[model samples]
Target: MTRRTPSTSHRRHQRGVSLFGLLFWAIVVGFFGYLAVVVFPTVNEYFTIKRAVDKIAAEAPATVPEVRAAFERQRAIEYSISSIGSNDLEITKENDRLVIGFAYEKEIPIVGPVYLLLKYEGRSGQ
Candidate 1:
């Protein structure tokens, strides 16, 4: 058997890994980073709205109209709060205070479906 020497060009070609691999991992990290920074906050807002709604009837004045008005105020607050960021959220009265809910739409990082929806509801205490 004859001993063969490796060419310098071959060594250079095999050095490290492909740039494509690095790029692929970069994209994945970017996506997850976006989820952590952006998506998580929107999700938090959904729960926040839910928590706020759950307390509305208890915290609001003891009247149907008062509850309704409080929900409307919540809607306004949702819009105002979301406007400060990339997350776009909306609140609508479904049926009295028993079915009030919120929906959100966001432009996800490198993802489609530019909208996300979330709902919450509560009933008046008798």
Candidate 2:
């Protein structure tokens, strides 16, 4: 049996990505990263609002107005909330428990004249 050495062509066929390919992937990753940075805050804010509402629901207020007032108080203390208000809530009663529901939209500007509208909804009872 004869043993043959590997050809130079085989060695020349290098592995891994090219500079351009690397740059392209970097840009793609960077874009999604920036998108996450922009979008995450909105989602986080929605969750914060949801948590506050849940707290109010857990307290089990006596009436719809009282529910709104409780939320208003929470919002006053929690400076992170700016998009929601008492009027925005959908108050109802279920199983003799106060349920506070709300739906709102957040407009996030990604670039010039381009915005992302995030719609968020939650119920305090759930």
Candidate 3:
């Protein structure tokens, strides 16, 4: 009868994640997932506002007041534009082209006293 001893090379070849390592990776993935869930709505709102600005700019009302009023009307129609009002829009005329610009900051709470600040800025054009 022959008895074989366990080889150190065989033990080294067998590898898998430990419980602590698994939990660490899980927490990392979960944290990013949570961040994405929190930040998605604000990103959606920014795009919506950008669309509204581009639409208003393409129309290009006669005067600055008219442009502001037009944005107000658009905002009333789109309920997601609560962050910035008509007064917040920067209306400019450059080289016979009417430009609509908007900038705003949004703070998303991740934890107690920890917030993610997002600054969104955009102008109407191609």
Candidate 4:
């Protein structure tokens, strides 16, 4: 009977890593990457909305009727974004500032029904 060397025994015991391990991690990273792709745009849009709201606020009309008209214009822009699909934008006036809110839908590649909403507030120019 021949005895096996320590190195041979170690090599035999140390089996190569399974493809499944690599595949599993790949799946995880792919999922996160997909999520980042989907979510990042919405986040960027939220920031954009914030900046736009500030600009609108800075330029809003001073009178009540004009303020209402300003709101209507804001609504028109919001509805346009909503028409595309899972995104909605809305603006409201509170006290002396206008509050802008965004509703973002998270539909996965095919179409999953998860939604998220983000809001921002800013003051209108007098």
Instruction: Say which candidate scores most in TM-score.
Output: 3
Question: Rank by lDDT, descending?
Answer: 3, 2, 4, 1
lDDT assessment of candidate 4: 0.53
Query: lDDT by residue for model 2 over 6-123, one digit each (tens)?
Result: 8522456679999999999999999899999998878888888999999998998888788889989999988888889988999888787778899999898878999988889999
TM-scores of all predicted structures: 0.46, 0.86, 0.91, 0.51
Off by over 4 Å in 1: 1-17, 74-126
Which structure is stronger by TM-score: 1 or 4? 4
Ten-residue region with minimum lDDT total, candidate 1: 83-92
lDDT of candidate 1 over 6-103, digit per residue (tens): 75234544566588989999988987787677667666665656655566744735555665566567767676334222122233344454433444
Say which prediction, candidate 2 or candidate 3, comes out ahead on lDDT.
Answer: 3
In order, the Cα lDDT scores of the candidates are: 0.52, 0.87, 0.90, 0.53
Q: Compute the lDDT for candidate 2.
A: 0.87
lDDT of 1: 0.52
Candidate 3 residue runs with Cα over 4 Å from true position: 7-10
Error of 1 at 61 (Å): 4.8
Give me the candidate number with maximum lDDT. Answer: 3
Q: Give the CA lDDT, 0 to 100, for residue 82 in model 3.
A: 84
* lDDT at position 112, candidate 2: 98
TM-score for candidate 1, please give it: 0.46
